[model samples]
Target: MSAVRGLEHVVTRLSDSCGQGHSGSLLEAPSADVLSCSMQAVVYYGVPGDITDVLPRIGEAGIAVWGPQDGEGRDMPHARGTVSYALTYHRDHGRYPDGSLMSTPVLEAAGMRVDWDRPGMPMPSRFEGFVHSCDPDGGHPVYERCSTAPKEPMSMAAARDQYGTVLTFSLGEPGSSAYQYFTVPRRQ
Candidate 1:
């Protein structure tokens, strides 16, 4: 089967298994936070044989995969001789602010400043641009930066106090357009 077809098959099997609520099922429904926080679906699967032929097909499908070693650097358990992989698919919603895109020049032309020296900010070279909407109360534009590097973590309170309402952050994935987008509400 084609890569896309293969992925569809995997998704179908997983969906069926989860819907059945079978004990010891490999996949489970995502949490509420995972649903709200991002526009992506991740599926984990294990195979009882070498994936040498499957890897190329997965690459052609442009799906991000993580396997063998998990987040904690431990080898994924896959019986006596098997491989496990996590496939990530990012869903495209639409453009921000009425489908009109913004560039770096446009933001600068509008008198909005790019704060580069903020702690945990990505380097200038990795900066892509910004997507912003005006704060109606004061006609100030709230900006969100897109970058190719991950920013250091900061508390929500600290970020709001420092950047006002919107916090500048990075989503670093080499050669991928999955930019991280976050918005913090104004402090009450």
Candidate 2:
């Protein structure tokens, strides 16, 4: 809407740079070109769900950073199968099997950056995102509201069946630590 269109893409320039120096120092004066190119926003719809506990269970589910693993099943740092962050969601309600709730859903909807779960999977995600509640609430009229779950290779259901209520997450630069949102739990 015309109302929200007024504000958008607000970012400040960076003044520092990383470099090796002869003075035994790190981050020399930023090269003209280096400082010239501003840092592209590093944010997207980061679905940060909870893992009933936050450790072990998630350990079993490998993120396989770039893609699948090698024959030995070790993630090659420079290879496609490196390790990425593993996420889990839950409800503070009950347990599973008999289907009880666990933790909580922190984002409206989330997904992997790419779909590597398919046959002959193509290049991973170029960019992945979900609409912040503000985005849907007309935060920016020019921005389209992304109200949906992420796609294949990045889906939680296919990965691990976990769900919760009050999905919450941050908004922007000074974006808050956590904002709760919503989701359907498989608990009965």
Candidate 3:
């Protein structure tokens, strides 16, 4: 599947004009104040995972932008959801399904900023991620160190290669074209 691209925006601050705090499902409170705040950090609402593919220096920077859609589902001028919050969620509290927190060093390398430790802010209960491999289908190759079935969600444990090189992780669906198109660059 070809990637569905959207415009990229750099959020520098979160606006609180609506007088709401970052608690509750971003999906439910469509009118949360966090949505209109400065783009500096992950505010409210979760977006589609494809933004990670276009964001700069990911795993080292910040969340990808998942632009908003119109009534007909066309890309709107503004973004509705963010992977930044999810990245911040992983940075502050996300644990694997087995109870282990992610330990990827590159995720904290710093290019994007997320105020993940707000004292009383609430976050999403679950997050989806995509793992990349050399295979165009994002599948784990037979006899290879790390692998996943094409388009199927895999555990972080299953995504890590024997060499300890993690491909790429995203909040998008594993089978998404944006996820599959993401390739882990070699060290060279």
Candidate 4:
């Protein structure tokens, strides 16, 4: 399937699993320099309480959930919890529709390589063995911290390179601390 279509399918499944009244929108990499070869989307919804129980439902829809780490663990007390998904897709005809090259710096930082010459290859899975930090101060000293910590301010190119074409689903009250914590910065 085409990358866009695949992303749409993921959105649909997530919406279904999460129930009605949710909204979705397209998201672009915050930086012009960090172009992706695929489309991106984000789904937003409200949860009456903790989202812990809803996680299994999300998993049933075939998306992997990376973390449900609480605010205390990540040093962000305002956030009840946070989770992330590394959306993946296979390139159509082995290339981006606009023929853009994935950011090399992002791949290098993640210790990954993309075989640009190969057609219809699946995007590489996220580099393993690192946990993203949610420290609001962006001063976590963990050795295995993910390069793309959400709460930390990052360059647009860096965000694009790390997330690529992705679909994010956020659960929380709009304008609440949890919601703000999940919001990614658009400027460098």
Report lDDT per candidate.
0.24, 0.24, 0.29, 0.25
Model 3 residue runs over 4 Å out of place are 1-56, 59-64, 67-81, 95-159, 163-188
TM-score of each: 0.21, 0.18, 0.19, 0.19
Kindly report the root-mean-square deviation of model 4 from the true structure over all alpha carbons: 20.7
**Per-model RMSD to reference:** 23.1, 19.5, 20.9, 20.7
lDDT (0-100) at residue 45 of candidate 2? 20
Q: Which portions of model 2 miss their true places by more than 4 Å? A: 1-59, 62-68, 84-111, 114-188
Best by TM-score: 1
lDDT per residue for candidate 2 within 68-108, as digits (tens), equals 44577543332321222212212313234456543322211
For candidate 4, write residues 1-188 as lDDT tens digits: 11212222122111101111112236642232221111111231222222233333443443322334344533122121212211111223222457754321111101111111112232242312112222222222222111232333333234334434332343322343332222222234
Clashes of 3: 15
Q: Model 2: which ten-residue window has the lowest total lDDT?
A: 34-43
TM-score of 3: 0.19
TM-score of 2: 0.18
- For each candidate, how many residue pairs have backbone atoms clashing (under 3 Å)? 0, 19, 15, 3
